[model samples]
Target chain A: MQIARHIAEQPTTIVESYRSAARTLETYAPGPIGRVLLIGSGSSFNAGTVALPSMRAAFAGEVSVVGPQDFLRRPDTVPVRGTLAVVVSQSGASATSLEVARRAAAMGCATLVLTANAESAAAALGLPLVLMPAGDETIGPKTKGYVASVAALQAIAARFGADIADPAELAPNLEAALAAAETRAKALAPALDKVDTILVAGDGADFGTALEGSLKIAEIAGIPTAAYTIEEALHGRLHGLSERSLVLAIAADEVGRTEASTVREALAPHGIAVETVAAGPTDALPTPWCTLASTFLFQYMAVELALRRGREPDLMRYPGLTRRLAIKVDDSQ
Target chain B: MQIARHIAEQPTTIVESYRSAARTLETYAPGPIGRVLLIGSGSSFNAGTVALPSMRAAFAGEVSVVGPQDFLRRPDTVPVRGTLAVVVSQSGASATSLEVARRAAAMGCATLVLTANAESAAAALGLPLVLMPAGDETIGPKTKGYVASVAALQAIAARFGADIADPAELAPNLEAALAAAETRAKALAPALDKVDTILVAGDGADFGTALEGSLKIAEIAGIPTAAYTIEEALHGRLHGLSERSLVLAIAADEVGRTEASTVREALAPHGIAVETVAAGPTDALPTPWCTLASTFLFQYMAVELALRRGREPDLMRYPGLTRRLAIKVDDSQ
Candidate 1:
């Protein structure tokens, strides 16, 4: 499948995607936006999380990420006026994303759509667009689309005011990670397959990587995965940990790496296996790019686990379940 | 243990807790506060989430909930001035909570502490305190503390501007839910016990209840639980659904109920057993109270699952894990 190839092309694609949309982002959400509301479902929302820190650093305003349902349920939670809703979706036709975009526009806030499909239903809404540079994606689980979304947002943040690290700086690390993934993923798959539950923990911006990675693992590898902000793993989830559980900790910086190690040591006595992936020393590359590499590694791990289990990575086990709930249509109403 | 009895007394305790803090809340976070930030960890964070809608309705500005680690790591993500940090902790000694309170104060935002202990380290930070009426809970899983935290925030929101449904009005419903929980939880235990993974889904304000309940189940019942917003449950989680998976759908209103039922119907084809807990009609009591009843039911369900598995509900399994992460001491440093 081209999924693995697409994942490997992330370092180059991110820079191209940013360069392609630099001018649009300058005006897409221009003017002192009091708050930036990133709304999406699944991988799209997780992608926003990966770019959240840079957005916060760029703008002297609050940046928040929530699933589309949250905004729909409580529009009052968001600033109706000075807020810009950055609606991200691989397929902009998703009913939830469209509804959120409409609602955001109706509230007099500007809407910006980032997706692989510019001709999608969301485009018909006449919102500003930042089309993914990777173009069309046919895979069931998104690989290129997710990274593109993050990279595009990083471009927007840079235009806004953030001094983001250059994507070109991440090329060597990305190539190294991708080159090493197949062997590492194959080796890790056996241990992961033996586990009943997987907990992926990360701190700071990289926490988004954990969430994105866990979702892919759950979707493709058929593993029951729970990804939390590293602290949350301790707050309540530790009770469910046992010898059968595997903890994959993704750390972007030194403090996060220390905390992840402490968590591993704490769970060691309970016979839980811990796998740590330290992405960077904080200054290696952009925080978002560090997370991209970690996420890419986990994506490969998911494929390897699925391959080991004799299951098709692209064809998820319960194929119909996700499709039925992806978008709701009410003919009766 | 008196945990069950304490959980049952939540109705009366909530009203008393609110009344006791009514004057303090009115003055503590007074005036046209531009935005409100609620910070906590685990159940404390969930409690803030339950109160988010009412707070949004009451305030003219944005209302947000973040774990303490989020605020501490990225204070730039939160507004410095014209914001109030409502910090909730069952025990006022949680190091993370204390650090967040200090950081928010340093940023010139007023700090309000809502906790059971008024003399603990968090209260010693000299912030305004709304002491929990439940008082002196020692259970590891924190059932009463969770409900009490939500009630305290609801009271604060009422004082802010929201015409929240009265806690007194919810007493009857709360009592009814508690009464029904024993039989219902015992019945539901067997089905849940057979599952390899449990997925809990809820929409709107009630989503917080789902999160808190899932945490408790993970803590006490030793289940790998993933609590997600209704849309998130449909996004990528469905790929892991099987005959061994159990879905607990919590609905706070008609729309939520319908959406949850759609989730159930979609997952049914995948052999996932779905349990829907329709909290109330939208206009029943108040959104917060309906969630309270639903949360109470799940608390009992956790207890029942624990008892059925010959585990201690009050003394959670792997007790040392939480304690180790609860405080970070720098002896080596």
Candidate 2:
């Protein structure tokens, strides 16, 4: 809650920090490197999801988000050949991420490392490093760290050429959105307390954000949750839907707003309560949406839900599970 | 074993029949479309893993493999403006796939249905139907169905400009491959009786085949098995490497042969025995490599593995579970 209050107050600071970081790219990254590769693990990966569309729009080329494991496995499949490889890691020393950066470097790629630790292995790859001040981590699961990564990515997007429509004008709006999130988080406390399963749905670019939000709930609340694209939810998965199931619909912009509304309407008729985190009213005719704002809201909601249920909002019991584990690939041998 | 023998003996007949059915694609699919959406559920989707590269290379445009659920909830994202929807289903009446076909038709896109049942909803859609004569199963967990689906896709590829480097010339080699697979299936009885898990790995075009092979083993033998690209295996998952983990590496063609060999050699150093099915001499190599005559060899390997385990090769305990699932979109309503 203290961290949430801090976020509510200094939201603009995070945004400003991100903008500054983005500007640095123009100076550090030289050449016609056709595309961008946003790499991260876990929460950092979630931030990359939000950054992708924005970066793609700004860069006017292909922008893909791949996990460190994916890069290590088949670097060739990645769309960006001889392009910028942006490596994001929370600890900076994430062994898998470090190896990926090394692999990229070995492949003659211009590696860019983004992390909280300036001297991490990922940074040691002799890449231009963008280091952020470490955020609060009451429990190791990552709340503030996630937000900080988002801030960094957002700043990078603004710097590159994002049509963000005036940062000075939008700063107060972002703060207000955070405030709105705080208010909504309190209202949703009861539902979060009882619900064991949550389904988050989004369309297009927001799909990845919904996935990250669902993952956050799973990691923080220790609950079973599945995130899907809005259309994917309409498929066989809806069979698992019941009044008991909490549905979180994330609608970022007009691009997917209609589909999200259709999903909300469909679920509501089935007596399923639908909660939305968007830029405008769920009932609005045409809503202006911000995916970043919506993602942050849901993330905050998940954290509050965990705290209200007496669960540690940041500590993850399932970290380093075999399926999620990352190992350094010593390519030298 | 009898089934394997039957398949081996009638390889040309089966291939020709499947290829003829695949020719129907030209009738339904006329010209270049904006996108090609391939829809399938579970193991059927694995076929897309193979179809993706080939389709993209031939079509030279957007080709995405989506679950039917994804199509239903967000029809707009289905690339309806200018798209060809290909739905792959074993039992033509799969509820989710049916919805996917219906939605694609509603979107005014050319719908191509590939299935074993010509009378199923997929066929009734009145689109281009590639019917596999594999027949319906009284005992069903998708043993023959999986083989039929893969064969159908391959046949379609071969028909639709799939760089088949001398079609008639490849026929004899394919027949021999099937026969070799039958011989290897008979020989594998000893290994099949002992091993609990079969880990399959491939790269590039063959990666999908490896994934489908692993799924077949899991479905039929009811064994815990996993599949990954040769590169993915070297990531963190190699920690599970042991002599007990029966490694089945499918090294096909020039692309993935070297990586597959590297994986085989790496496993050998760990004292883990590796069995490879390839087009070349796998003997001088570290693994016990069998020169397979056809891709069908892996299918027989799955069947033989199941038979040796004393499990009914085709048992679907989760009945209606398939219908309740959506490959592209959910149509439970």
Candidate 3:
């Protein structure tokens, strides 16, 4: 109920605040960083998938994204010199992210913390912080927090040298995208209603977006779902691709469009019903009604999918489980 | 047949040479210099998993391990300063491992290239090249390459700071372990005969060992299989645990004894047939056998399993498929 009220009151403003914060980052630290590492846990980690392509395009150097769990367990894999560590967290108190931040600082790398809470431990670690304005959620499972993180990261990418042709045009496009998403969500609600398993796919920038979309459905719908890069899905996992599987493909940009099309083609032969929301053809201004718009639509679709299955779209029962088993950090050793 | 010959002729001198090289590392570098990063691919990476616990115990600072695929994908996650990058490869031609070495050199990290070929690309990069004397394999899949990589890394650990109790004592222990592994494999062959799917479980050092064991089975036996850390196995994946699932639990030293015990206990409750290969008692002498002996046993068991299922263990129709597809690096991009 608390999450529902928060969602009802500030959905548009939360999206707007993300746009504003992204503009702030562009104004502050613009241009190529030597290396970029995105680290987070669970949904926060999954959120990084959405930003992968954009981050690679924005940062001229190598971009590597991993779960904080991987980084914590394998710190030596982290570059010690001239590297930028971007720690992503919704609560911002994820034990592993904090430890990674501490380790990165000790190794003398430039660190940036992104979270909904600017005052969280990650921010307190003296790193430059990007705070999402979507406020906070007391919900046991993340819904708003997840979307807010994606929007804030999108803003960060836009601010920090994303190859967008027109920066000033982003706001209106984003607004339109959200509206388009709502309409699409309503239309797709029926198909999502009866599905027990889902498969989401994308490539490049949308790969992470597809992953987040899959996680959103899993966390909210309690349905077994998996996400894969388009190429990886085709390798061996394609055997699981079938008519009964609800395949959601996000084709957000030119890099992913061809692969997304290939995936759709491959699945069609198997009689799998494919739902594709892609960046519209290039002649028009890259409208939010296309790629960026599809993200919100998928989030809405996941909610509808949950409702279609007769599950509450917002309620989560697994509260305190995450905090209790907060990623075990071996600080003592 | 080719793989069998490669194993039979694999020089014991290679083991001796690795021991000498490890001693050289101890004499020069002694104790942990900074952070140590172990990098490898396929079987070589599997060797790192076996070496991790002892390496961590011996080194003063952090010791983390990852495969070349993971390292190349996320170099920013690796420590860039005051770090030593250990690149392990048997052939040293492995594209990913070579790239990792190049990246480490670019980052100004001290690099140690361990390989069978002294003139390998990884070695030619002018890092401290420690050569193993293991001969070439005609078979596409690894056999002796797997064991040699482990022996080489184990020697390095002993040299750097691994508490092996007595260095001179390892050779005899390794021989005994190999013989014991052969015996165990034959005894367990009956259970593995009919299994179509295999699951391997271990904790700590053996976690990586189990992964390699499973990979060998998958690559050689051509069966669907997966390996997970014992803790990860308990996290919902246990639902898939079954009698049809051939479970190989590698119970190595005290480092993993508790979790290994838990995995063994958990499986029986689910009616999953479990086989436990005791590497040693909880307080056994620290040796590769303590981690690897069980893995070696399972590799042969898996082959027998494949034989019973009417599949030829050595003839891989999928040879180079994983290398060509599963791990295609976008080097051009």
Q: Score the docking of each candidate (DockQ).
A: 0.70, 0.08, 0.08
Give me the runs in candidate 3 sitting further than 4 Å from their true place.
A1-41, A44-333, B1-17, B23-35, B52-83, B99-109, B118-127, B165-168, B175-204, B227-283, B287-289, B320-333
Relative to the unseen true structure, what is the C-alpha lDDT of residue B15 in candidate 2, on a scale of 0 to 100?
52
Better model by DockQ: candidate 2 vs candidate 3: 2
> Candidate 3 DockQ score?
0.08
Isolated chain A TM-score, each model: 0.92, 0.84, 0.81
- Each prediction's TM-score versus the true structure: 0.94, 0.61, 0.59
DockQ of 2: 0.08
> What are the RMSDs of all candidates, in order?
3.2, 9.0, 8.4
Per-residue lDDT of model 3, residues B232-254, tens digit only: 44332333334556666666545
How far does residue B117 in candidate 1 sit from its true spot (Å)?
1.3
Using TM-score as the yardstick, the better of models 2 and 3 is: 2
Compare candidates 1 and 2 on lDDT and give the better one: 1
Estimate, for each residue in A93-161, the C-alpha lDDT of model 3 and write its tens digit. Answer: 777688888887788777777777666776677777777766656555455666677666666666666
As a TM-score, model 2 comes out at: 0.61
In order, candidate lDDTs are: 0.78, 0.60, 0.61
Report how far residue A168 has shifted in candidate 1, in Å: 4.0
lDDT of candidate 2 at residue A61, scale 0 to 100: 50
- Candidate 2, residues A264-292: lDDT per residue as tens digits? 66656556667766743223212112555
